[model samples]
Target: MGIEIEVVYALPDEQVVIPVNVEPAATIQDAIRLSGILERFPEIVLEDRMVGIFGRCMALDHPVQAHDRVEIYRPLHASPADARRMRAEARRRRRAGK
Candidate 1:
């Protein structure tokens, strides 16, 4: 049987609640599409993009359970590993009084 679930979108200034009729085995991406988020936020490009569910990184096609919170992640401009390396280098220099 189809189920009704609440899909929430955390926008810049507001929250959008969409009640969706979904099969119990739908992925988070499917839920977002059903929620019309891609239609609402045209800037969200999903190809090769990372996604998270309930604050944990997950595969794009990861299955979403009922009441699951899905969050689409935008690509970072810089690599986090590189940023950390830079910070560590700066700290080393400061310690050496250079």
Candidate 2:
């Protein structure tokens, strides 16, 4: 028998979710490959990337259960601290103009 799972990837302008069926023993990587998501999005390089199940990060080798939603994560363009700093600066600028 097989398990049904969803593999998802998102970009700023687009998102894709592919439903896949794999053997019960399949791992996250196996489901991803079976879904053909890699082919559709050539920019997804798994070696340096992180993946998750429902919002929790997991290793590529992690075994997937039925109905699992596997997500491919994109690298952050800015660190969390840097992003917060930028937002604070923007807020200060707005207040000064008012």
TM-score of 2: 0.94
Question: What is candidate 1's local distance difference test score?
Answer: 0.74
lDDT of 1 at 74: 61
Give lDDT: candidate 2, residue 16: 90
Total backbone clashes of model 2? 0
Runs of candidate 2 with Cα error greater than 4 angstroms are none
Residue 86 lDDT (model 2): 99
lDDT, candidates in the order shown: 0.74, 0.94
Which portions of model 1 show Cα errors greater than 4 Å? 3-19, 78-98
* Residue-level lDDT for 26 in candidate 2: 95
Q: What are the models' TM-scores? A: 0.62, 0.94
Number of the top-ranking candidate, with TM-score as the measure:
2
| lDDT tens per residue, model 1, 1-98 | 76665556565577766777778888877877887878887887766656777778887678887767777666676699998999999999999995
